[model samples]
Target: MTETDVVVIGGGATGVGVARDLAMRGVDVVLCERGGLGAGTTGRSHGLLHSGARYATADPEGAAECIRESRVLRDIAGEAVERTGGLFVQLPDDDPAAFDARIEACRDVGVPTETLSADAARETEPELASDVRRAFRVPDGVIYPSRLVAATAESARQHGADVRPNAPVTDIVVTEGTVTAVETDAERIEADHVVNAGGAWAGRIAELAGVEVPMAPTMGVMVAVDVGGVDSVVNRCRPPDDGDIVVPHVDRVVLGTTSTPVEDPEEFSTDEAAVEAMLSEGAAMVPAVADADVVDVYWGVRPLYAGDDGGRGRDASRGFQVHDHDVARLTTVTGGKLTTYRLMAEAVSDAVCERLGVTEPCRTADAELPAGDAEKLDALVEEFDAAGPADTDIVG
Candidate 1:
């Protein structure tokens, strides 16, 4: 029988992050994932390291968290981030008034913004719409999701945490209103605490523990085109909308996304309409994107929490919530975005420590993850290099 102080279910960024934080604080942790690391929504993300400017107007709290976390990640996880700053372009057709508000919102939240003229913006990003009226630059970048997860998992393991991928949690052994063990396919692992960082599947895990977690699995479609013109992350100057953002990764530029509620997180399929809609919307920002060949089409499910009273789509609150089932000794961390995963982990870790009576404060914000496997990274780079220019650059 496996024994541990905490059992973390899920291997996405947040799960691994929580394990890393707890393990760093000298808490014995075991993280179990049903599939390979980053095989879920974390891998499907567009790789855009947010600067919080996107949500500055709609959700300032989330925006603030993102900016602070963004800087923190850049500091501690520098190797996993690409410093490709972001730009918000306002075309002549877009509302110029909204641009002013966005700038103010970013400023109010401590997200620096620099205004640029259409010509200046085009000079920086030639693919930007020629009719652009103004542009604002934000400290955005791209994050290597797979590398980040792997590094965090590795750090957790080094700190005496056990990370077991492909070990699905079959059941949560609740006895007398408190979780005592977690049943997996391989073994029954006993734990004093359980953290449900299952992302989209948090609702199912919560149900197993006999708790209600209202989660709306929302799907967003992203299309990758085999063309790279814009060098920075580009966004529409207006409110959050579908396909209004273009993120340039390694070789291909990723265009996305459309948000729609889905019944099952794992059962959604990509369709031609969604792909076309993304392309059509993205073309407004980068005209060359319309002519580029589509390299891939994928979708990611966001674990959007639908409380008794909350909005959906672009209106949904991006803030994260931690549900501490004190009686059951289980915690569910859900919502938030990739950029704010660190903060989410910190919050959840704080709760876990409080429940366990551990007074260790969170030091993940300043602590750097151990260096990644250099030989493995070199081998990957060699493989991608031999595969030709079509392969997405897998730089760490």
Candidate 2:
């Protein structure tokens, strides 16, 4: 039986972030994932690095956190983040009074936002529709979730952390009301501490440990376009609707998303209706997007841990919750956005270390992650490019 100081469930950003932090602190750590890293909600995100402008009006606290973490992530995870900035545009039907309130709220939270004339906005982004009434530019950007998660795992491994893919934790073994081990398909591993960063599966994992987590999973769908038609991240200056945002990645622009309630997180699918709605709504912001070709459609489920059936996922607090089940010797971290994943990990690692009597402070924030080096990244990208397209021909 293998043994470890900490066993992290889930391989998403939060899980890998915790693993890296603990391992860097000289504590034995192991991370197990049901599938590939970032295979869940992490990779399916909108890729926006919030400048805190989005939540400035709805939730000031959340907006402040986003701005603080956005800067930190930009510095540490340079390769994973692109400083494209962002713009909140007011369309013909949008209320100018609401836009004024949002700008004031952003200023209150110390977020730098500048109002621009419609022509100025169009000058910056040629694809933007001339019908735009007003625009506010903020310090928003883009992030590659897969790269971030991979970098975290690689950093943990470099510090002697063990990472196992396809290792779905089937059961949590507790004796005398204390967690002692976890069972997977292949074998059982003893764990002194367990951190459930399972994203959407967090509530289920907590239930296995005889605890309850109030996660209300909500499904969101995004469509990737082959062309990069926009210069920066464009958002509708009001409440989140079908496809009020267009996020630009390296070679393409992602039009997203739609929020709807779902019974099962794993079974949700992106259909034609969702795609059509995204295109229609997104077209209102940039009329050129109406003719863009969609490359792929994907869906993600946010683990919003508040309210009942008709809950508002985006409206729920973006802050995270860390539950320490002393009896079960386990901790479950839920909620929070992708922008603040590192902070979330630091909190979870600190709690785990305290529970296990490890006095090492978290070094994840300071320590440069594995892929922080540019040379290593170039090599990996070159290798992937050299592999070329896979051969589909196979003999049975």
Top-TM-score candidate index: 1
Steric clashes per prediction: 0, 0
Per-residue lDDT over 1-396 for candidate 1, one digit per residue giving the tens place of the 0 to 100 score: 999999999988899899999999999999998887666778778778899999998889889988999998888774567789999999877898899999999999999999998889999999887788889999998877766776677778888999888889999998998989999999999999999999989999888888888888788988889777668999998888888888887677888788888778988766789899889888888888889998878788888888668667656666789997745689999898888888899999999999899998898888886534544543433321211121135643
| Model 2 score (lDDT) | 0.80
Per residue, candidate 2 scores C-alpha lDDT tens digits across 1-396 of: 789989999988899889998998898998888877777788777878989988898889989989988988888885767789999999989989999999999999989998999999989888888899989999999876756776777778889999886788998898999999988878888999899999888988887777877777788878777556577999998866779889876556788887776667788665789889888888898786778887767788887776344345666656788887756679999888899999999999889888789898887667666566555653432322211111000000
Error of 2 at 365 (Å): 2.2
Which pairs clash (backbone N, Cα, C closer than 3 Å) in model 1? none
| Model 1 bad stretches (over 4 Å) | 371-396
TM-score of each: 0.94, 0.92
Query: Largest lDDT belongs to which candidate?
Result: 1
TM-score of 1: 0.94
Residue pairs in clash, model 2: none
Error of 2 at 68 (Å): 0.8
For candidate 1, the per-residue lDDT at 177 reads 89
